[model samples]
Target: MSQARPTFQPVHRTAKMPKAHTEVDPLLDALGGRGRYQLLQYFVSKIYAFTAAFQLLNFVYVARNIPHTCGQPNNISDIFTAIDDDAFTINNSDIFYDKCSIRVVANISGDAETKQLPCLYGYSFDERKELSIISDMGIVCDRAPLKGLGQTLLIVGQGVGAAVLPIFSDRFGRRPVHLISHMIVLALGVGVAFSPTFTVFLVLRLILGLFQQGIVLTDATIGIEVFPTRYRKLVAFLSNIGWCTCHLFLPLVAYLLRDYSWRILQLGCCSVSAVIILQFFFLEESLRWLVANGNPKQIKRLLKKAARISRVDYQHVLDVYDSLHSGHEQLDTKKEQEGTLSKEQADALLTEPVVHTVDDETHSLLDFIKDKRLGLNVAVLWFIWFTDSMTYFGLYFTSDALAGDRFVNVVLLIVVQMPSSVAIYYLVDSIGRKKTCIFLHLITGFGLVGATVVRELMGNTGTGAIISTAFSCFGFFGIFGAFGALFFYTPEIFPTNIRNVGLGTSSAFSRFGGMLGPFAGLLSEYVTWAPGAVFTCCCLAATAMVIVLPETKGKELPQTLSDVKGWYVTTDDKRRMDSIAKDGDADETPGQHGL
Candidate 1:
């Protein structure tokens, strides 16, 4: 009933002798295994952890030194007792002095003697209405020039450190550079703790910023490099989470320790720094840097260690490594299958792909700006960074104008920022880069606008104004949280060769913005509310300008400028060109103008 099937006779053949050498894994053979990358990422995260801990410690140190004690100083109370101070009729409730340093006192009616003085620090008191404003002259008399400079220097240092970190990371390895940064910060902490004069303390604060730059730069660079391209944003963003967390607790620290001396805060920070130094010693150098430096032995050992920790089989890891180095092994499968290969055949089959490696040599700064794309991106990032810091620090410094309860206002501001920071780390990878940036920028701009409206409505009103102020705080806080993520995003867009340079330029502009902050305050004195309006406008501009940027969500890093531009070129061609340059094999002949 069915069609007859065709039958064929099997042909007998003799088995061929196997070749002396053969390749097992071609894909793995071309490039090294994934283990090196994995280990490097792990090291990067640890570096972030240490830096985060130190940053928190710095905040804690500052909180403890606030100069307010819950109870009276022992000597004063004891001396009073010895003198039979009960003659003064001081009760226990009145005996305890509250910490009220660094407060804004409102002066009403412009009279030096008869004017009412409102204590900006009385938010915790039940009889809040008892506070009354003193005259503007009295208010002006209360604030010291040294106090202004102190605030200015603290922020300026932050700007400078962030701007220059890229250079430190690229030159010195991340671990050593961070350790040095920690030492510098620790010293600054000590200086801030013990300085008898305000001027010396302010100067030291600026110096502390220089060291802080290394902390931020090295941690960021290492963090980005260690992770897979897909996770770089997440790592960078999560790293920012530490900053937000520090901010959230800032209010609590300011409240609980507000009564203590500032020196105590610095001492606590120094203690934390010592602990961080110990934790950091166990951290390994970036495996990425080691491999890029062509340290095979170290790479293998690091990979083996990571595998052991990850609970992966050592043999399986070895197989992956073997596959990665197959080209290096130089297996001659075809010749071996036919017959044993002669020396000439072995040599011919053992061909290797050329790789261009970076040399540990100094380069000119001009080299960073050689490429147009890099230069433009750097410029764009600079504006974005400048605006970001301007809005964030500017608003925070002026919190007194918006809310009646300064402590609660600042704490609320910091708390709202934490979730936004955590969200950025989570979404940087899940959502594409461009979209995420655009969305956040838009939100920040609107948030600032919303804050302005609230500020306007709060125009000298009482309880209602206070409530509106808290809502506005929410908006301002979100803008700052977005800023933390942007710090990492700008650096990640560039190639390794120019990444540090690009980031440095951007960060420098950011510092410039910080330097200009005190000026903004001065400007506000001349034109009230103008700075806030300008900040809102800048946010809008940054948000819109971000649209012009090319999306780099999951793209592989290019080896050359042309590759980076997505110009037509194969990976092999780029590799060959790099090798020729490194080996000095190519003549120094001029190429076509465009290339």
Candidate 2:
């Protein structure tokens, strides 16, 4: 048998070299690797934040609590006579309640008994100061409920946008949706100023809320995407400074125009948005989105423009694009080979499929919750968003009801948020996302609790207000810092494919809290401390959840659920990728549409 076996000659072969493959990481390479393009996007995006501040907080003045009481036109001789400070007090409570019914000493059945009656004369608001919708329509007594209603509607609209618009941004494109929404906000905003009645104003405000929320979220999300990973916190901090600037500037606008109508204030705020139109000239569509959608032509044009402005070599962008295309083609070829051959044959050929990327799957809100770790993280982030919103709006709304000159005190409360951005610039990076969240939420909680205690100890005295304001200062700083860090962290944690959904969903939860804030303020009717205590507990609860959250400090931004779970690529895939990235030369026009 051995002799019968044919002698096999060793085949002499030429030693031909295998082609080296090349791969390009878009977020790490391409235009983002350069600083100037990232900064340009940041500059364009942050400007929207400034204008947005005016639209968001204009309600502070629009439905503000002016000095209003039941009109006394019939009782001419004693317009304000013997109007006991406690005339409108309810249920033997020590708190003053003058917004609704008026007290009248009457003679029923020849016996004198004080009875509460509807304000027949219509409430007369203070004419010595700024006018509002409440002033014009006399929104008092039976309409006292309407004041809080308007604010709630505005917040509800934003919640609706959060639930809906991200889907549009995902399906259509961020640029068109963002621009269109901004235009809607601007047009409706001006209409809010010229609104002839409270009904009209409320309707206009709802529409304005719908679009303005989209503008801010999309603009900020685009900024987060285009920036270098290392500087995400810094970009967020700077973007939010516009909010602080608006706070400072709004007080000055309020103080200067104390005698003006609310309409004028609304118009003034809407005008700032006109500057945003200039974005059409310079702002580039998100390159990440462009590539994902498989529009390399657009990507090439935008990247070349960005490269020119950023002083990067345009040839380098072309090289990167071509290289990525080649690698993809090579991967495709290997996939075909693997599909056709047996496992042993495939191993002899040395090939496997590529790891899944974000664009491979269809993204939706469900993706955030369907995955276990992501679901838990999303739930925790949702609670944090809810608590953050409740406390922030609670304080901003409550500041108006403080003992001192409300306008002046509101300005002071806003002044406190100014330094928070500066602190977050360092805090987020130094201590990491989880630690920063815990520390900030804890500080905010303790600050609120401190405020409640101070008010109780010192009563309504000016001294108590000062002490409480100090506590509020700490609270605002902590909450604002938390916001900046959360904005940066939330986007980084999610993959690009569903980032808009993740952020929008989180914001929707925040709006739910905001929608509840006005209702929560109603708790003060039962007991003044109830609202503060509830939100403070919420903040502390956020702290507890945050402590258990995973840290995302200086890590490569996760582009998929597997990446979030810290999975590594198989050895074969890794080696193939390396070779493809190094040696592959791609056709310039690979006609594949991205997700």
Candidate 3:
């Protein structure tokens, strides 16, 4: 019996087609995939960008640490008064004055001791600019930790949303999940803006974070999957540009209304959220998704729309469907068995969409670490993703810590990131993913180290400020480049069934780093260079981890863990694709969808 078992045929079939002719999604590629149709869909999806830009960074001004001091009954409140009355060092570059206390006057005499007392009357804030939750809620000095808590908690909601929202996206559909998130985020933004109590505002921030992360990631997945491989970078590129555009606009809005209430800014940002409803009118569900779900009826309608938008004749595509792959035979079979059929009925049968058989097998997060190669890849990339967020949030969050004007510094941060994202889109194709990651990571580390060194050598003078700003710009540029390209790489490595979850979970892991980053920025209170130094070490460590991942550039996306487990899957899969490429309808992979 054992010997007879060996007599069976080999597992693999002989490949009859050329190796170079790999099969692709013909509907996406062959029908002018990157045409205005797909391009328009990609661009319209940027409404999420506007929401993200204003919502994500809204915390910056909302919690900005304006000038404050001890709550005296009727004495010095302004910083200038404290300096004039000899309460503080005259040109206190080091801020040697104790902000928590002030010298009091004897009944009718001169000066008294620097009495260490709390700001019991509630400290007054520099309200020349925007009124914020900080000014209203008194989240100062002792309550300063609450600022970090608020930021961290907001990311907590983001983490929860990242894990939960994508499940809805994968199970039901991307559109519904996104639309729901949009509505909730709109309501939450308004709620946070007009929140009467600090507790309510914090709670709303948490809820807002959750919905914001969900909407952005789901929209990102839809945008990416709609395009064929050749135009994928365009989607990523446009998204970054959209985010940067919003950031630039935000600063202008903040500056213009600096003397006004912060609620006005929140209302302005929420107003842009109306664009989400407009998406419902024009955006169609993914054709690939329809094919996978075996909805030939909807698939046909959407395919016709795509074809028309691409300027191709819809009837010619229909004719091809009618002529291909036992299409007429299947319709005839149904007609004979059931008696007669109408034109629409026959047409529905003509479009024999490829239906994906669901796999009973499941993938767990720990499964990412159990497979030898996959585990190692997951661990390393998770670290890279972590550092990506740390450096990103750390840079901007630390803007106030820097010597220059906060607005100009933030604007510079965004301006530098713009070119880096663009550079990576073009550069990833040339240098390969491994080198791109390592090189950019090293550059970021160098900028951190360089800034740390200059700040130490020259002290925090104007010259040192210029030098530090230059280096920080370098770090920001590198961080943006590496982070943007990594998004393309991370999802491409995971299989489709778990792709949304995988991206979501990895994002949650990145949020772990983000949650801690603001605290690192807060460390600037103790030492000027602490945040940069800590972030540099983290970036350098990530540089080493970059090499553990295999080069994925110019490769077909891995369809399953089996595809990732061994090299043979790539070779075998390509052979199978080549064999089916000659017949477009036959090329659709069995039990597979978009990939």
If the candidates were sorted by their TM-score against the true structure, best first, what order would they fall in?
A: 2, 3, 1
What's the lDDT for residue 106 in model 3?
30
lDDT string for model 2 (273-346, tens) is 88767777767777666655667788788878888777877888787676665565665665456545543564
- Relative to the true structure, candidate 1 reaches a TM of 0.66
Cα displacement (Å) at residue 106, model 3: 2.7
lDDT of 2 at 58: 69
**Compared with the true structure, what per-residue lDDT tens digits does model 1 show for residues 108-200?**
244222112222322232221112111101112233244455546655776677656666665556667777777777777677667665557
User: What's each prediction's TM-score?
Assistant: 0.66, 0.79, 0.79
**Model 3 alpha-carbon drift over 4 Å, by segment:** 1-8, 11-24, 70-102, 107-117, 128-130, 315-370, 399-402, 522-533, 559-568, 571-595
The lDDT per prediction is 0.53, 0.68, 0.68
| Alpha carbon lDDT at 145, candidate 3 | 74
Full-model lDDT, candidate 3: 0.68
RMSD in Å for all candidates:
13.7, 8.7, 9.0
Weakest ten-residue segment in model 1 by summed lDDT: 9-18
Clash number for every model?
24, 13, 2
